[model samples]
Target chain A: MSDTSKKEFKRSFSGYVEICENMPTGMITVRGDLNSRKLKSAFSKVVGATLPKERKVTLAENSIAWMSPDELLIICGYDNVSDLMKKLQKELDDQHHMLVNVSDARAVFEVSGAAMVEIIAKLAPVNVKTLEIGEIRRTHFSQVAAAFWLTSEQRMKLICFSSVADYMFDLLKTSAVVNSKVGEF
Target chain B: MLIFTCPYCGIEADETELTPGGEAHLKRFGPGSSDEEFEGYLFNRENPKGVHFERWRHVYGCGKWFHAARCTLTLEVFGTYSAQTFEPPEEIKERIRAKRPGWKWRNFS
Candidate 1:
């Protein structure tokens, strides 16, 4: 693969709140009848964790989140996506299911520090103070839609469409600047 | 600025996370129906000022469709329920009755 063709990525800003673009990661969407025992078991086996209910499960290097009633998003190392998808296909062959690798379709950003929640609150309606670790919420950040989950007390992971990544970054920067000014006053 | 709870995801989603799907529980008037019935199904709406039931999609949340019971005049939400059924659940109707006596929307009294 030519390095020049690879899109250059960077974290646009960092200060009281640190923003960093995560390394390329694998994302797979699994859609099926979640009520089916066979499908549920297949998903648990492939992801090495049970399908989370109204929350996300993080195991070592992978995280599985419930995206909808019938859909789940699995995040893992970039190189493991193909193998994981194949394994899921084999395990779910007897059932009706759809698996797609969506790694390149979205961008993930890790935001942390004292002002992280305040910055997120400026962009989305979510009350970061009440959001528990491991809980995930999908809502509009500024004008674009995104999904976010807290990884720690001061850290969160936000995923948004790659097409709107730049717009989202700008919103974050503006929010951070405004928040800093409010703090100074 | 209405907030609705998605029955599937159990999240009290903000209006921004949801998309209005217009009136809920509309009976379809398809083939063999009268012109009046078809027109009513296509265009006619109660647009009531009192208790109303509507459909909403949690587009940014769990992506599930759900029903919301609210008063149009006051914008007070009575309750939210799943959209899988043809009518509001009995519990939701009861709740509405407690808050607004003799409130009638469709079949619910």
Candidate 2:
């Protein structure tokens, strides 16, 4: 509960588009056998969020995004993360799984506008033109590991390591320069 | 500019998103082995011009290690497979032979 132990920083860059840092969010890394019926049902009970398909996200009271073949990230309210983690542990105690609270290890951001696709294209190698709703793209921005998904229409939510938040913010700001839109997407 | 599809994640990742992990399916020869055998294991490597299988890590994405089979000269990717094998799969080898018939990769022919 002390401010000195916190690395709280917020910044915004409004150019041809709006780019802003998001508040801290709850993220839990759940790695296990995703094909298990018990894991699926327990996830629904713990957060009421379904287990998402590969490279997709399930949006409920809490959102669950598939990070890899056997890894899913459960996103909930930061204050409720511990409670949810305990619930998940109790639900799947007998099953083989690894659960870790990664809320403070990442920084989330939002880039919204018509040219949001082009802004991401400037840094990543992924083609977002055909990205369906709730589809996640786990790619790197220039040199750092990052992932993003379309949380809603015309709004993309991105997450990167906390240590690279400043660098990612600068990349987002530079890519969102006025009139620099490539218009390909 | 080579794009490799990660077998685990099922995504075609650009070379920038991947980190090459040298050749794949290398058998280790440690102590008690003959000098020639250990030397061959550590120093010798296949440099086939037609089909070569190598290891790659999808570091920026799923962070899984997978094997890729491709040509050393033309840079054409025959296919990509999992890294959980001591040898390329039979189907992958057959596919490579179909592309470059009589292509011999070390003793794999």
The TM-score values for the models, in the order shown, are: 0.93, 0.94
DockQ-based CAPRI category assigned to the predicted complex of candidate 1: medium
Q: In candidate 1, which residue ranges exceed 4 Å CA deviation?
A: A1-9, A178-185
Candidate 2, CAPRI quality class derived from DockQ? medium
Q: Per-residue lDDT tens digits of candidate 2, residues B4-109?
A: 8889988889899999999888889999999999999999988776789899999999999999998988889988998888888899888887888988776686
Per-residue lDDT of model 2, residues A87-182, tens digit only? 999999999999999999999999998888788878999877667879988999988899999977788999999999999999999889887877
TM-score of chain A of each: 0.89, 0.93
DockQ of 2: 0.76
DockQ values, each candidate: 0.80, 0.76
Looking at model 2, the pairs that clash are none
Best by DockQ: 1
DockQ for model 1 equals: 0.80
lDDT of each residue in B1-109, candidate 1, tens digit only: 7887788888778888899999999999999999999999999987787999999999988888889999998888989988889998888888888899988876667
